[model samples]
Target: MSSHLQAHAAELAHGFSLCELAEGLGHLDMDGADDVLIMGICDDSRHAKPGYAMLCLPRAEGRASEFAESARELGATAIISVGIPVDTQLPSLHLDSMGQAGTLLRRMFKTEQAGAHLYGITGTDGKTSVTWMLREALSRYQQQPVWSTGTLGLMRSSDDIRDIGNTTPSLLTMHAMLAEACREHVHSVVSEISSHGIAQSRIAGLDFRTAIWTSMGHDHLQDHGGYGPYLAIKAGFVCDCGSHGGNVIANADHADIRERAPASSRWYGHGLSRDDVDMGWEQELPGMLRLRSRGEEVVIEDIPLGDFHAENVACVALILMVSQDIGLQELPELLSGITAPPGRMQDVLAGYGQVFIDYAHTPEALERCLRAARKLARNRLIVAFGCGGERDREKRPQMGEIAVEFADAVWITSDNPRGELPAVIASEIEFGMQKPYRAEVHLQLDRDKAIGEAVAALAEGDILVIAGKGHEAYMEVCGRRMPWSDAEAAEKYLRRKNSGTGLVSEGEDICA
Candidate 1:
């Protein structure tokens, strides 16, 4: 276990009596189970331990009740079921809905009034970028620890990251992390709130200081059933945060977001003339960005990335300005040292040309990344990416269309074919490519081979983008996660080609 988890476990060592838990959760009638002591709470049976209550909830694949016996054998003291009863001799609490789980867990973990200033960023893309940016800027400005949680995992710093399974962790895990942060004297936390997180009520009962909407796109339709519902879930988060007295920061460039966002939201975007949007930015030179808000303007120099980052930077600036009372003059210095999060346009320098690895799985994100790469490419732009299995299949062809439209070359490869065939996913993506493909496009099922081939083919002044699994260190195949990394594959091929030894040097893992 990591020191972070260890500290969190230790914090819960005092435990809570069954009566206290029931009263905190508003369940006044505990009857005979009032005296049972609960040390921890767990949703997964595999992690259940002595004096812990096992939560048997509904899941996509199966009911958690199927593993109640395992949890019992592992020393679970009680069972908490949501709409489903578990056949166990252990004392249990039955609830009608999952919405109460977060409240109950927060009470169990003693984090109902966590001191950290919680900032939430939600959208299909830019969530990870904005979350990390907030962490960096806030940590620099406050001169204290600032934590963040999202696709990159629960991170206290770049060097301290612990994967809690999903982008938005389970309710039990979320409260536990917050409790840990409080114990560490961390004052701020930025989190990426996914659509699935909102729909599943993972963030329930938590108060956010600010809710940021980055950009809505065509992604996660499979999990939400359709685009409208997916969008509703995103909008619901922003509106809920706003209604609860939290500041709402939205991207004015996205019409859907602009329309659905609360009227009181603070808007930020590029080239917007609306009076409501006080935050806007533009690239004045190759490496300089000028931000304008109200009547003040600040010019940031030596920006290492593309124009797409202008909006992300502007969003970060707006948050600091409104929430932290940070002046515009202070932004240039605080943001000058900020870097993109791992797997977010991370560049690996080669002897010839440039290679970037990004987690651009959505069509909108992929197009933006390719467009940025095009501006830096003097020769040709090549991209290697693949769609994940069992996701929004409609976007596969859309991404294929976008890749060919902006990139001079494309390589379609496997990106975690969990249960579906990689060939089928590639074929679906290829179906959307224009007939008589304008660019040199190849369909390779082997991801490492595809990345190696792309790197080996790079020419001077050329740029290659390896997309889909940015900072991820593992590939999920046949229900097993194997160690893998796109950046590592690209660098290995580049090293071998440059050395002429046909041997690659083992490089240190880059912090994500």
Candidate 2:
């Protein structure tokens, strides 16, 4: 990161004065220098910096006030307390809700995007792919700098790209990115909205011009506490978009999604024709997808990706049609060359088989990846996957069942077993299958070794799908994120095997 990029990063890390923040909060008891600059907003004291204002919240360790004292010791200049006035040397502002205060900070800094069209995509899956398509389409057709942030991090039309490490970043980071985008004179902005982001008020006050709900499925059950709350969080994004007078697009294939999404939302799906559905896609040729909407049809030719991605393309097309006024005639050409983000159904060549790296951690996502691989596999489909630790534990078994049902041979392995024993997570996954499938399941806690064994097992015409931790470069185990990459591991293993050198490449656990 250069100094210029650092400044932009700082822009995402916003700063505001105590007085301005208090004004935004409306009913806050403020005692201290109103002019003291709050140059940073942080929830964790560890991230606190000089002139930063720490928001005291209830953490597992202690209450907000307990952290406030430590933040002051760390050079934090101010504290925004929720219902508790910490006795710190620095000034403290009391508010009823810290989440509300987070929203206010964004508003006070005026980070709301201006002078461009803002688009949002929310769903369990396909958010990154749909947002990427929209970014590429908008940039190509409009011929302006288009910016996008989400699973792929920040994508500017220029060569520079930065990953913010979260699908939906903190409110401060989102605001800062929007502010920076506005400064760069970007013409279009697309963001992937997560259910957690919506429920946590991270995207509060963002006024989108258009929004899309790709599809609904089970995910993040632990974060939302239950499935109902999880669904509500996703619907909240749609409601917010509608409230802001933005056009909402949703997948009509799922009846629940269509019913829960904003009533005025346009829909896209397969084999559907109705006034409500604005677009639909079907297989018109052997290797192409045909999109039909408004009595017009466009054939997307030679799409090299999976069948599951056609829905993502249709969703993006509908969003563009509504937001950018791109017709079917020109839209197909614009979308012809769009590519999937790294690790989302990404295809790489193995020694005698094909390998796919995908971030499909959930059951539905895993199923989709396996289905896609099956369509392309000539002989058999081999899958290497594992459930993430510290997430919704219930999904672990479901994902295990899905992998075995779709893949001929299954390798159950470790996927970022953060703070949990890898063997424990693998055992829970193995618990999901019956005798037939369970008999075929192979457990290798080492992900690299699992991938290596999977490739070695693949026949000439077989396809290998490596799920969970797609583009991520680190494997977190016991609170440590060590450098690891599935794609790099696959490439190295194949190259080594091709050279008749050895199955094990340079470096220990390169693929494991």
Candidates' RMSD to native: 4.8, 4.3
Estimate, for each residue in 1-512, the C-alpha lDDT of model 2 and write its tens digit. 20122221132245567777777564544465667887766767777778877766433124566677778888888877665546666777777664566566556556543776788889988898888878887888888779988876787853667766577886667776777777788878999999877876667666777888887888889989888888888888887788778899999987678779988888888864555578988864434778889888888875546777777777878888888788788877888867677788877662343888998988888888788788888888888888888989998888877876888788888999998888899878877776555325677778898888777776788888899999888999888999999999887776666676656322222111
Clashing pairs in 2: 12-176, 448-511, 448-512, 449-512
Give the least accurate 10-residue stretch of model 1, judged by summed lDDT.
503-512
Q: Report the CA-based lDDT of candidate 2 relative to the real structure.
A: 0.76
Q: Write model 1 residue lDDT over 160-211, tens digit each, in one string.
A: 7777678887766777777878889899999999988889877877788899
The 10 consecutive residues of candidate 2 with the worst lDDT sum are 2-11
After TM-score superposition, what is the CA distance of residue 28 in candidate 2 from its true location, in Å? 4.6
Error of 2 at 267 (Å): 0.5
> Where in model 1 is the C-alpha error above 4 Å?
1-13, 24-31, 60-75, 86-90, 272-274, 350-353, 500-512
Candidate 1 residue 19 Cα shift, in angstroms, is 2.3
On lDDT, the candidate that comes out on top is: 1
- Against the hidden reference, what TM-scores do the models get? 0.91, 0.87
